[model samples]
Target: MRCRIPETTLREALAAGATYAAIARAHGDDPAAVRARCVALDLSRSRTQGRIPPEPVLRVALAMDGVSVARLARAWGCHPDALSRAARRLGLPTDPVGRAALRGGR
Candidate 1:
């Protein structure tokens, strides 16, 4: 069965600083779908408002051998995807295990 999220809940969640993924999980929907809906409804978060780790710290973390993105993100108190994005922006190698984890493989 398809999950139907109420518009009021979406608005309230957005106002309470919940991310699209968070809203999606709470309402049993796909994050990408929620993000698209938010964009269509003009309820998405600001582009510059998310967490970004410091370059030096990210560089050090990326340099560590055999470290997964999820572990590093937890250590840095940020989301894995956010850390991964930061690593990509800094041209760092995201370990294969970490990439697999991101895809829910491990």
Candidate 2:
């Protein structure tokens, strides 16, 4: 089944400080989908907003256990490549899947 949550309502709720996850729950939509939309919106504003990522969040992303870059990006509200670059800056592993594949290499 499809959700009845209007785009305007979703945007309003998020603008009012309601997280995309909360808005999705309230509207019976997928949180991931809502979050993706929100991230896209945020990226569109990044050019003019000058928002900087927190250092702690970068650390958390680098140290996240068994977390994929895609998952980290979702949590940090940014692109996977951004998180990967941050990890590289910290000398942490960048490609999770590549590392996993290497572990099984003969």
Q: Rate the local accuracy (lDDT) of all candidates.
A: 0.72, 0.60
* Residue-wise C-alpha lDDT for candidate 2, range 3-97, written one tens digit per residue: 45666776688667686678878877887777666665552123112222566655545555587767767765676776666667765565666
What would the per-residue lDDT of candidate 1 be over residues 1-106, giving only the tens digit for each residue? Answer: 3335766778899899898889888878999888877777777776435456788777666666667778877776667888778888876668766544544523
Q: What TM-score do all the candidates reach, one by one?
A: 0.46, 0.37
Measured on C-alpha atoms, candidate 2 has an lDDT of 0.60
Q: Give candidate 2 misplaced runs (Cα > 4 Å).
A: 1-63, 97-106
Clash list (residue pairs), candidate 1: none
Superposed by TM-score, candidate 2 places the C-alpha of residue 8 at a distance from the truth, in angstroms, of 14
**lDDT (0-100) at residue 79 of candidate 2?**
67
